[model samples]
Target: MTRIGFRLALAYRSNIIMTCVALVAQVFLLRMIWTSVYGSRPAAAGLTLDALLAYLTLANLQAFVTHTIVSRIIHDRIRTGMVFFDLARPVGYLRQMAGFQAGNTLGGLLLLAPVIPVVLLVGSITVPVNGAGYVITLVLGYVIAVQLALLISLIGFWTMEIGAVSLLYRLVSQFFAGTMVPLAFFPGFLGVVAEILPFKYMGYVPAAVYVGHISDISGPVVVELAWIAGLWGLLVLTWSRAHRRVVIQGG
Candidate 1:
């Protein structure tokens, strides 16, 4: 690995540790609240207890997996002009980011997955079964989440202060994406609205899979893929626009 790669890997290790700790704490807290409130209630209007627990776990993981302040990475680079060097590199800008993500994800699985099940076992909650639909939906969720972050990061092309933008992403993601609570809890009309928005694909639709709600997942998948395709187009378009304005240092 290059020096930068090594450095990023070190940072990735720290993220993995912190993420695992956060997941553990949050899961226990959620279990406490859920047990108290869901004593015997259906997971959500009609979801089974087993399904709810699984959804809870998967949703928690999804939150961490997608949890990142991406705008800062690009904003800081832009402000300091370090990204100038990136412009001249042989590899594409987005490819560099994909490398970092690959490393971070690899490091995260070491801690996040191995310890999570053990912690869940303490609650004696039934682990969510990985049905074919559940697995496919969740995999799709991961892809959309990465796209969401990339979309946010690309905003640095036009905005200097991405803090507010990133915060906006988090707010919408937490509430609308079903990370904080399932969309099923929302009013029916509101839930239907959430269903159509691409944001829900970030966490909600996948959690639905964990709960076996994918009687039909085609629509959700189509929506998510459309967002992915659209966002990638936007990212490329922004890059093309920025290429004109960006001051290349070494070129």
Candidate 2:
């Protein structure tokens, strides 16, 4: 399944190129904006321009790598009455989705490789202060991302057409996950809100760990794990219940 997913990802050459181009442009423009914002001001919210750049670079990379294609895959299956065939396969639906997401992540990383050097050259990115902690957080972040995406994809079972819900999820995730801006930079109320949300653990915490903004990694990691456990159960339950309500669109 993983091999199949990998091959499918590799097949999308044009999509990968366009995605890389868009991400590069976004990172470049953000660097300019942050640089201008911090001109002659050493730091704001304890983040220097260089650190901010590093954070943004990693956040964007993580966002790209962890972005989900599962919703569309599931949606198409349901639409074409293919999900019934898929559900009957021995592999099981959730694991099948995971394999595909894993493959997509790997393919995205390949697409992301070119942008890393470019971002590094153009912006000052920090090295991880606690190497092991950073790695742990990063791996957990991917797990959290996949789990969240799985939950979203399962919503198609209820909503039938999940495009709007998926879009809403993306926007909410981007904001709360700190992909758009660091949670620390948000207004006081929103900052507090972001802190309480699991989204921050996905992109921001890992990037912050690498850049030395987050020194105590245990708290965030534990919270992220808890979310993963809870979400995993939710996915299983949703899948079971959704199957009961599923209506095959056609033969």
- Give me the candidate number with maximum lDDT: 2
Write model 2 residue lDDT over 1-251, tens digit each, in one string.
Answer: 67767777789867988888888788888889988989999999999888888898878877777787877888888777788878889888899989888887787677667777876666566566778888898888788878888888888777778888889998898889898788889998999999887878778998899899999998987888888899889888988887666645332
Q: What is the C-alpha lDDT of each candidate?
A: 0.68, 0.82
**Residue-pair clash count for candidate 2:** 0
How do the predictions measure up, each by TM-score? 0.84, 0.94
lDDT of 1 at 164: 85
Worst 10 residues of 1 by lDDT: 1-10
**Model 1 Cα displacement at 159 (Å)?**
2.5
Q: Which RMSD does model 2 reach against the true structure?
A: 1.9
The digit string of per-residue lDDT tens for model 1 on 1-251 reads 13344355456676667767777777777767777878867655777666666666667777776665345666788777787777779988877765555555555554566776765664344534546766677667666666667667777766656778888878887778887677877888988888777767767777776566656778777776777788788877877766655645221
What is the lDDT for 189 in model 1?
90
Estimate the TM-score for candidate 2.
0.94
Q: After superposing candidate 1, which stretches have Cα over 4 Å from the reference?
A: 1-12, 122-130, 247-251
lDDT of candidate 1 vs native? 0.68
Clashes of each: 0, 0
Question: Model 2: runs farther than 4 Å from truth?
Answer: 247-251
